[model samples]
Target chain A: EAGVVQSPRYKIIEKKQPVAFWCNPISGHNTLYWYLQNLGQGPELLIRYENEEAVDDSQLPKDRFSAERLKGVDSTLKIQPAELGDSAVYLCASSFSGGDGYTFGSGTRLTVV
Target chain B: GESVGLHLPTLSVQEGDNSIINCAYSNSASDYFIWYKQESGKGPQFIIDIRSNMDKRQGQRVTVLLNKTVKHLSLQIAATQPGDSAVYFCAERKGGSYIPTFGRGTSLIVHP
Candidate 1:
């Protein structure tokens, strides 16, 4: 089966610009996640969705970051007026459920200057 | 024996030797544990996983050990190869939550 798919594998934007990333989870998977991975560090959860409802978004920066999963199939993560600190890999993952193992996409590498 | 950032340890082993990587999980309530291998410019790929009820599990040329008492997890790669050189991370999932917490990852270098 095909794994989770993400769009725009790499992106470059100037500071204060608006950027968006898209993700499509695997078929039959009910859980989707967005994570930020800094250089030489593990992924940090930004938001998690169980269907269309976001179950965990405590780690997300609501000031500039927002994520939405519509119809429980596709997800979008956007950063308006992105800052230089937002440069990193944005990973999207999917799972059958909370207990199931996750499958991640190649991720979108964002470089904010 | 040393850390790069946030205890991101690095391990080096010969190709013909066995290699072991260790991880320390934080949540005692976590019931599922997984190990992931990630190459440069790529996302994490599943390696192996073990439940809280089990202490050890093995796969082809790979092994995972879970110690619930101390919340320690480990991955063993037998007959390490140059292809095994990458960053490995451990993740834990709680019984009722869908979010999994990930470790800082370890850099494994297999010398040929």
Candidate 2:
């Protein structure tokens, strides 16, 4: 079985440009998550979805960042007018439930100059 | 105020030796814990997890120990190999919560 899949393994954009990332989680998994990782830091949770419902997104920067999981199997994270600070790795993970069985994608590395 | 942090930023050990990574968490309500290993240019991979009800759990060559009293978690790798070199992070979550707080990660360097 394929693990979580993400598109555009690497992306480079100038500051103030809009950027988006796509994720396809493992089949049969009911929970999906989007995380951001900066250099020398662990991945931080940006948002979480449980079967199309975003259960947790307190850490997400609503002003510039938005995410959606329409079918509950795939998700997209968007950052409008991304800034230089937005440069990092965006990872997507899926699990059978809320607590365990998590599988992660290779992630999209975003660089904003 | 929920946070998880590692004791060291890096750990260097001989290829055949064992390694222990430590973490401290502030959320006493956290009942579930997990350890993840991440390599360069890749996302984190789940290593092992333990619930508050249990004190210890083991998998393959790795073991996770939870100490609620001290709010501490540790990962022990036996006979560490070069392949084990990666950044390891600890995450904790409470009952029914979908979000887990992650630590900064400890870089393990296995020397040959």
lDDT by candidate, in order shown: 0.88, 0.92
Q: Summarize candidate 2's per-residue lDDT along B1-112 as a digit string, tens digits.
A: 6789999999999999999999999988888999999998889888988999999999999999998889999999999999999999999887777567788999999999
Alpha-carbon TM-score of each model against the true structure:
0.91, 0.94
lDDT of 1 by residue, A2-113 (tens): 6889989999999999999999999988999999999778899899899999988999999999999989999999999899999999999999874375789999999999
Docking class of 1: medium
Clashing pairs in 2: none
lDDT by residue (A1-113, candidate 2, tens digit) is 88999988999999999999999999999999999998878888899889999988999999999999998889999999999999999999999884457888999999999
DockQ of each: 0.68, 0.74
For the second chain, the TM-scores of the candidates in order are: 0.91, 0.97
Model 1, A39: alpha-carbon shift in Å?
1.5
| TM-score between candidate 1 and the true structure | 0.91
